[model samples]
Each structure stands twice: as structure tokens, then as C-alpha cells.
Target: MATTQSFFRIQTDANLQSMQVGSIMRKVKSRAWKKQRYFRLQDDCATIWYKSKKAGNAHSTCKLRWLWKPPLISISDVEAVREGHQSEVLLSIADEFPPDRCFTLVFRGRRGNLDLVAESAEEAQSWVKGMRKLIENLENMNERERLDQWISDWFKKADKNGDGRMNFKEVQDLLKMMNVDMNEHHALRLFTMADKSQSGTLEDDEFVLFYKMLTQREEVLRIFQDYSSDGQTLSCRDLEEFLREGQLKQDHVQQHSMELIEQYEPSDTAKMRQAMTIDGFQMYLLSPEGSIFNPAMLEQHQDMSQPLSHYFISSSHNTYLMGDQIRGHSSVEAYIRALKRGCRCVEVDCWDGPNGEPIVYHGHTFTSKILFKDVVTVVGNYSFKTSQYPVILSIENHCSVEQQRTMAQHLTRILGDKLLRNALEGKGSDLPSPEDLKGKILLKGKKIGGLERSLDGVVEDSLAAEVSDEDDAAEIEEENLHNDSIRRKPKKSKQGLSKELSDCVVYCKSVHFNSFKHSRIHSKFYEISSFAESKAKKHMKDAGAEFVHHNARQLTRIYPNGIRTDSSNFNPQEMWSAGCQIVALNFQTAGMEMDLNDGLFTQNGCCGYVLKPAFMRSVEKRFDPEHPEIRDGYRPVTLTIKVISGQQLPKVNLKEGSIVDPLVRVEIHGVPKDQARQETRHIDNNGFNPMWHETLTFTIHVPELALVRFVVEDYDKTTKNDFIGQYTLPFSCLQQGYRHIHLLSKDGTSIPPSSLFVHIRIKEGT
Candidate 1:
């Protein structure tokens, strides 16, 4: 067990053997009602018990109400645990309890809250500390251990006979639980295969083997058959045909084919035969040295100690919504999903709620609302869960002063020291490095007096006078709320920030943009500004170099314009080209843009922080996005890829019994006109394993700025072709060999081991 400082004196009793810590009175469904329950924490789960009285003899009885386990009991599960008053300890569970009594633990199988009232503040602190320590320890367990525990728990649940083995019926139910739907005949065949002893049932070891078989794909054998001529082995002639037809240049085809054959058939006896067996074919495809995506790229480390402003941060726009901006439901799950996928920056639009709380949602829209406290709690729990780099909470505030105070209080209490309440190192002239702010949360929003005081502390008097004038204007606006004629007059602009919340603004203070020149003159290290995609593009077109130079010293965020009501995303590469660190996308929506974003950030350890290119980082170097000749640093190259064959290409839009005519389209996305391309040709009818001995080539002028995308689609003449799957990679990362390209869904998730076999070659000049 991991050691942690105890909040109170450790209680040692005979009951400790049963794992029972203590008992307390818990508020039930309503605050007025209370129930007494004893809780026990075990290695894998926590259990609750009830005290029973029989003939004046009191004893503790097991209450099989609910079980809290790892994965399910994530960091976000326990929302907040804080002292309500002197003896009352408030606890909040995410989306499990009633809104009126959210400060209670709602078990999975039970209703209402477990808002326990500890004997004293010290007791409450002890319970909270114990629970948090248990959760943290569970989270810190290695992946293999967690997987083993999960598998063991699942096996126990599915083993209905309690015989430590699973029969056919139980196996069927287990498959259903795993969300795998297989025909009865196929499932029985697999079961029999796994039961090597013919015992009519599967033990734990056999069950694990069966599970692997169910999920594993036969991509290698399928592709090997496609390349073999006699349905047994691939001869030298077969290899030559596969390579020559794959679009390899005539000058290079003969030499490359001979080299591959000699490499696979290394022995003199095998060389005399000039053939590659099944084992050799498998080795060539599965070997890291031959794979299209170099495994070494993932191991290559980059600098992680750069300043926060010197990196392009993976960010999300409207992080609370999962669908259409106007009517989408606001959910804490969105934040969890985004953070888990390496989103370092998240946006929250706060408004006043029905009670004294502040809620997050799209303002002035019909979207659903979630508590601001809930969002903050979720962020605090998940901020460093994926990446230890700092998380920026971009706030769009529209709350009144009272609710703003509630927001500040909840954030401070829930986030604790993780929240940056003040500038670090006494407010340096430059922003802190990512290394300095690791595991911290920075609040970014319009702050009252932030700009004035940040201006060398010399504008304090003028800012004070401006604040007085603003307060007078606010009083007049309040008076006009009662008069008809006065209300008809133009309303005064409301203050965007509250004094209480402003104190939390440390490094990232959102500011309004006036002009490029004006921003350069007034912007401070702590100040950041956002621009709509359209406005940012306009500025880039007008003063591209100036904007680039400005972003070198400070931070600028670019988001999709307001016209994207459907929650679509803009091409983030465009904004990234201009040195904008925070290129916020609608993470809820997935498309080519998201794919590109995923591909770019797939490097740098997917830590949600990638250092800018040297040219972009240097003020002296002039790297213009519009004109590449000014840099002249990139070289022209020809990318030749052959669409050889696909293994278990998923059915795309065809009926259950119908077959699909699969075709591969190769796309090259780059900055120059000659480099941007879409070329498609070959199609095959075999859905399980289709072979198309065709090659497509693209000549790219700027290989550094290019991306190679391979899309698999179902051919249809009547309507548009259906998307099956795709794989996109940076041009710089593409490996040249007989390689396998693993396919991913439109949402950028790996589609099992389904893959396409291709031979790629990159030549020096167009």
C-alpha cells in the first residue's frame, strides 16, 4: 500500500480485520432524513454495512447494496468532499444523486446520497483522506495488474455455476457482456478449439485464450494468400509483379524486388528456389524494421522543458457539449473524454443557475446546462490524468457577481492548491515554462483590473478612476431597469469579470483585441486573446508576418467562427501555420480536421504539448505561410505507394448478406497546389481479403508540410461511395518498405488490427 500522511490518529481495533473503518449518520434521499451505516474499504472494492439490534445485542450485518471498483470509480466519480459546517461533511458524486442533495455518495445500485455527518471536522478530514488515498493507489496500479483484476472480476461474474470454469452458455453470456456478437456455430467452434482437453468447459486460462481469439484479426495470413501465386508460397516472379504493379518506378522495380527476395530468402538453398514461405511473409509485415509507421518515432523523445507559450497546445472549443452547439446536452463525460485524449486546454461558458450556483452551457441557447462546480471538479480530477502538463481552463463568463463568487469558492475548495490563485515567481516579465507549471491549472478569462495592474503597475490610478466610472454606469443601468423610457435607451456594457474570480487569474488573463499594433503595444505576458477563425484569417491576410511575430512573444487562441452552429471543425493546420498555440477545435465533431489534429499530435508523446518548429520560434527567421520560397528549406519528393491488398476490410453500408466492392483512394494534403491531391483507381470484390495490384504516386513540393492519407471506401455508382476506414500519417514519418497500414475509423480510433498492405518509396526529386 502507498503511504500518505494521516489526517487523524489511526484507529486500531479488532473490527479492522473485517476492513470496517467506522460508522456515521448519512443523509438519505433528503437532507431531513438520516441513516446509520458502516463502511469498509477492501483491496478491490468498498462495501457498506448496517448495524442490527436483536435482544439488546448489537452487531454489524453485511449490506450487499453496491460495489465501488476501479475503472468505474474513476477520479471524476468522487466529485467533491469538503466540510459543510463544523460536523457535516459534504460529498458529491457525478450525475448519480438528485440535484437537491448532490452532496451525497450515490452508489451504483442504490438511490439517494450518502452525505455522511462525521463526529467532528477532524473525523471528516480523515474519511476524505482515506477515500482519496485509496482511489489514488488504485489508479497508480500498473496496467497489467488492473487488466488482470478486471478480467478476474468479470470471470467471477460470468461463471454462473461457481465451478471456476465457464460452459458454452456462460461463455455466450460473457461474449454479450464484452459487446461481441458472434454466430452460435462460430462461437461453439471457438469454444471447442479453446477447450484443448475436450473437457466440455473452459478454465480461466482457456477463457483468456478464447477472448484473444475473438478479438484477434487474421490480417497477415490473409495478405500472404493475396500475394502468393500457387496458394502456398510467393515466388520471385510473384514478388516482382507485386512490386512492379504497385507503381514503383521502372528503373527501381527490378533492383528493389531482387533485394527483398534475397533479404527474405537469405539462405543459398532458398535463394536458388527464389520463393518466400508463409513464415517469411509474416515476418516481413510484422517486423518493426519493415512496418510503414516506424515504432522508433514513438520512442523518439522531444524537449519537454520549453516555455508554455512556445508549444502548440491541443485544445477543445465548447468542451461541455457533445453535439450541435445550440441544443447539445452539457455533460461531464465530454470533459473526461477530451482530457483522456490529450486535450490540454478546455473551454467553459459559465452562466447563473437556478440556485446560488453557476452553470456551464452555451449562453443564450437552448443547450442543456451542467453545474460549474461539477465541471471544475471534473477538470481537477482529470487535468493531469493523461498529461502532466498544465491545463488551461478558458472561461467565457456571463454570471452575476453573487454567482461568480460561488464559482470562485467552489473552484478554490475543490481544486485546492492545483489552482493557480496567483502568479508564480512574483510575476516575471515572461510566461513560465511548461516545466514550471506542470500539474497546475491556469484560469484564462477577462479579469477586472488585470490589464490595468498588469501594465507595469503604473496605470493603477487611471484604472481605479475607470472602475469608479464603470460602477456609476452600472448603477444608472440598474435604475433604468424600472423606467420605461430609460429602459428603451441603449443599455450600458456590462463588466465581464467579478472581483472574486479575478483574483484566480494568474498567468492567463483574456484580453480584447483592438489592432495588431495596439495589441503589441499593450499586451503583457499574462494577457492572452482569442479571435474567431474568420477574423484571425483576415488579420493573417492583412499582416501575416506581424501576427506570426506577435505570437512568438505571447499567446493567441484561434477558434471556429460563430457560423459553425452545427459544431463542425475548421482545418486546424491553417491556424497552426500562423504560430497560434491554441488552435481550438470542436472535439465533439470528428472529421478530416480532427484526423489531421490527431496525426500532428500523435508525435511528441501525445502529451498535448508540441514545440514549434525552429523557424516559427525564431523572430529573426522569416517563414511565411503564404510563400514557401522565402524559407526554401524543404525539398521536393515523389511518394510512390501501391494499394496491394486489404485484410478483413469491414463491410461499408452493404446489407448483412451483401458483398462490398472495396476501393482504395490515396490523398496527399499539403500547402502547395502541386502537392494537394486525390487519386483513386483500383477496386476488388473480396471483402475478407481483397487484392488490388495497383499503384498511385504523388509528387509533393513541400514534404515537410504534407500528409499522406489512405482511405478505403465501398464503390457505388448510384450514390456516393461509403467510407470503410482510413489511415493518415505525416509524410516525414512514412517508412519505405513492404509495410502494413493499420486502419482507423472516422473518429480516429484503431479498428482492431484491420490493415492494408502496401509498399512505399520516396524519391528525391519530382
Candidate 2:
């Protein structure tokens, strides 16, 4: 009971207390599909337990709430609580309920958002307010406290019979769900030890005790003992040695050692004695400070005053599509997701819609449409939430002059001062820095004869112009090739540009890419060009150095080829190697290519802008990634990563006979010379504590640009391997020494209690 009590111990407020009473909320999936779901806050305050079926009405309560199994929304899993009619899903049911009566629970990763409507607005506010407070409280919890809460939640979930106790069979089932494939005899032995009452069914404290024993990390104990002289407590000197040798903390050895002792040492006596016990050592190892990523690099540490073209901006192509290119739904949710993830650049394909408004969707396709104003509103709301850097709205305009004027009006009205209408007062021919244009949105599209206007600041909407390139050139061609809905049509000529929309283009004016020499001679700093994947790759191979020089002055965007009907992403690393600033990828897709993009922008505060190397940024000097040795600062690095072990590896398949056979794959993504991968042998029938202790080595020719990806896969000789978890970071962002690489789920969200212990050694090669 005490063990379980610890899990439910949070300072309960009025909102949480009221929520415990439960409410009858209508779960809205679509306009036609709305059902009453009984929602109640679990006693732990960490979960919102709801039934899958309807609750009939508000008066009738769930008889046995705890026993109402599965599909409960864990608070930690929720990314944000979107209130009002904030999403397209909620907007569909706008007619049935008032705005304040509806809210959406946006989950992390690729999980579909849960849209709910309450009987009254007050009920909705209570749930939203309560859920938000819970999330905030969860963020402030220590690692140990979070683990305790998790244990309690699992106890509630695994107690299938609702007896507040787990029998041997139930405990076995819990183990399997926890990603543990343990031997029956061993499990029985531990279960017997924890049953101090000698009862066949174990209670709360007993379950907690059993969990501690089961998850005892022997490998960590071995490492701790290796550093501790007494095999118990690490003295100040001993701790300093560990920091210096293991963590590679050379300068602040004594200072850092004492700081860590005070931070992680739970015992007051141990802290006073300047010693660290086993528990404290474990706590330190699991903290974010002990992560593989360099702690100093976590914040916006890089120089942000550099020109926008000097950094690799995190750009997304077709930000409105949540699914395949042709028939995917176009919703405001896609815009929200991309902006919330620190995407600095997003593409908005606009066309004429009902009521003389502009709509965003994939042109010439069966894709649905949402109002352009809705997309702008979402972008403005979430633009600076994750990052304060400038957000470029790559406008793919296919609208009439009236609708185009409406698009510009929506941009200025919805985004307000955030929209950069006029250029910065002090800026020259060179593009402004991310710092200079912080919290602003820039338009990237075709304009009528550029930024030429009369002295009175009057612009004519009658001025018609043309741009040589269509932003969705490939997609439109493919749409024409296979337009079953419409007859096969000729290649559409370039559409006219609206002077009103063109006036909004402060920076990132889209233009056709002819050649590197022509761009260098004719292109202005604000004029940007887009290239298809094939053309970009050809340019990268042939005139790589020249492309690097061109990008140093002007912005170059690379998008996936039109033939990719499945909405797949191209490898952005090649374009990045040539210093292309905006290499847009399909943000909805996930793979090694997306992994590389995630890795590169993970640092520099994850501000969606990573500054290029000095060589690439320099005007006189250019770095041809094709010939790495010719670079000015060509300090090659030899990286050695010793894969010690994996902790709590998730089960790829939860079938009775299936246990994960896990393997680790370490890939280096950079210049051709630095790109390579090495993997370790797979372990059989173990999803828990699979030890490899194998080493993978690579010589990165350009460590500054290289990204290292650590992947764990469920190996299958019979079929293709299943992805388990992965973590990626820039090669230079690696913290030298023993560190834990916390794994991320497929859609780049943290999967807690899943990590790999590895020792790293990076040395200058040649």
C-alpha cells in the first residue's frame, strides 16, 4: 500500500480533484462520428482513463473504472492540450458544439489527436485546465519520481482482476508487456522472494520490490565498482577521476565532481562526505546530463548573427499533406505539427476556394482543402513556440488575383507584425541573420517584377508577371499523367502572379535555377531557387564547389522529385554537403533521410537553423564535399563507439512466441568518404538488457557536417528487420566518454526507459 501510495502522491488541486469525479465527454473523430466517452482522472493523476465505448449519458457512471481496460491516454504521451476549435478535426464538429466546449489532446509522435466535446463549456475548461496542470507537474518531476509514477500506472493496468494485487500469472504477463522475456524459473524465484507475506498473490510493496530486483543493472554495477575504491562509495578524488577519465571532463574535474555529488547524491550524509553511492551513480547515469549529446550544445550556443544563407535551415515540403501526395487529407493539423517541431520553412500551395478565399492543398490532385487563413493562423500561433527563428512560408500560388490578394490579407491579418511585409531597415544585399529576423514569417514565391515600386509605396495589382519554375512542377506533371478524375491535359503554362501577394515577399523570392555561374552573376541575395532531387544531385556531383559558393551568397532549396507519388523524402545530406540552405523533406515521412535531417537540426538549440562550417560560410574559400581533403580546416576524426549494452529494448511484436532479436546499427552520414555503417551481432530472445560490448569505428573526413545515427532493430533472417528505436546527432555533438543514448520512437519522440550504454572515443586522424 505504501509503495502504491507513493505513486499517487501529488499535491492535488481543485481542478484535479474535480476531474476525479469524472465527466461524460463526447469523443469526436469526425462530424458524423461522435460518441459519449466516460473520462476520469486516475488516482495517480498521471493518466486519463477512458473507455472505448459510449457512456450513454452524464448521470450514468462507469461501474468499475479501473477495470475498464486499455486505450487510456497517458499524460506523458500527450504533447499539448489544444483548446477551443484549434484543429481541423474540431472545426468539423463546430456546428454541434460551441468553441469553448471543445478541445483536442495532441499526442506525441505520429499518434492521432483526440478531439473531445463536453456537455457544457465549464466541463471542458475543467478537463483542459486539469490536464495542462498535470503535464506541467510531470515536467518538474525528478527521474526517480517519474519511474515511481510509471510503476504505479503499470500496477493499475496489470492488475487485470482489479484486486490491487498481482498473482504469479499476472506478474508474468506484466513482464512481457514491459518488454522483458525472462526465464520462467528465474521469474518464479524473484516472485517468491518478494512474497514476504507468503501469499501466492503479491501486494503493492511486494510488486515494487520485485520490480527493483528484476531491473537491477549488473553492467552498471560493474562499471561503478571499477571506479569506486571501496566498491561502495566514490570519494571526492575517486569521483573526480571517474569524471576525468570516463566523462572526459578535464578542466573542471574537481568542480564538476562536487556539483554532481550534491546534485545526484540522495543521502545527506553522502553529500556532506563528498561521496557518491551506487544509487546516486545510477541516478547520474540516467539523467539528461549523462546523455550522449554534449550538454553544452543543448542550448542555442552557436553564433546566430550569421547570415541566413550560412545555416542549414530545417525546411518542409508540402506541409499541408499528412498522408500520400495525391489523395492525402489537407488539414491545419499538419501545419501545427511542423511548426511545433521547429521547422523554419514550410510550403503552402494555395489555390482559389469558395467565398473568394484561397485554399491550401495539393494542386491537380484528389486531396482535400483547408482555408489558407486557417493554415496561416496555425503557423502564426505555433511558429515561435519551439523556436524564435524566422519561418519562411514557401507559397506555391495557383490562385486568381482576388484569392491571391486574400492570401496576402490573411498573412498580414493573421500573423500581424510577425509577417515581414517590408524588408528590415538596415539590411543590405546580404540576407538577414536568424537573430535579426526572429519571430517573423517571410514569404517565398513569385512576384511581379521583384521589389520595384514607386516612391509613394503604391503597388499595382494589375501588373502581371511570370516565373520560369513551378514549385510543384513534378507533382502537377504526375497528376496530369494519372488524372482519372479529369481528362489527360496539356502541360499547364505558368500562372500570373498577383502584385498584392508579390509585395509580401520580403525575402526568399522564388526564381528558376539556370546554372551556378548564372546565379552567381545575376541572382540577388534575396532571390532563391528551387531544384528537383535529380537536378540537385547532378549539380552536387558536377559543380559541387561552385554550388557551395552560390549558396553562400543566395539560398538554394532542393525538393524531392515529382515521381515520388508515395510522398517519400530524398537524402538531404548530399544537398547539405554542398551548402544548400533549404533542402526540404516531406516532414510527414520517416526514414534514414528524415533521421539525418532530425540529427543535423537537433543542436543549435534545435532552432531549425544550424550554422555551416567556416569554410562553407566564407566567401573566398569554398568546401567541396566531393573532395574533403582540399578544405581549409580538414581535420579528419576517428570515432570509436563501444556498444556496451541496451536497456529495456521494446518488443517489435508482442505475440506469445515472439521475443525481439535486437541488433545495433551505427551509421555515419556525411561526405562520400565519411558515409559508412557498422552493425553488431544480434542477441536471441531478449528485449531486456541485451549486451553487445562490440565496437564500431569510422573515420569522418568532415566531422563538422557528419551526423551519427544509432539505431536498434529487431533482426529477422527470414524477413526484413523491424525498427525498434533510434537516436541521431551531429558527429561533433558527441560527448566523449561513457554515455547513455536515450532512444526515440519512429516519429522522433522519446521512449523512456529505453537506452543504449556506450563508450565513445574521438581522436584527430589526419
Whole-model Cα lDDT per candidate? 0.66, 0.84
Indicate the worst ten consecutive residues by lDDT in candidate 2.
Answer: 454-463
| Cα lDDT, model 2, residue 18 | 79
Task: Report the CA-based lDDT of candidate 1 relative to the real structure.
Answer: 0.66
How does residue 368 of candidate 2 score in lDDT? 88
TM-score of 1: 0.64
The list of candidate 2 runs beyond 4 A from truth reads 1-4, 52-69, 452-472, 475-495
* TM-score (C-alpha, index-matched) for candidate 2: 0.94
Tens-place lDDT digits, model 2, residues 312-369: 9999989999998788888888888888888999998887799898888877677888
Clashing pairs in 2: none
- Score every model by TM-score: 0.64, 0.94
Error of 2 at 391 (Å): 0.8
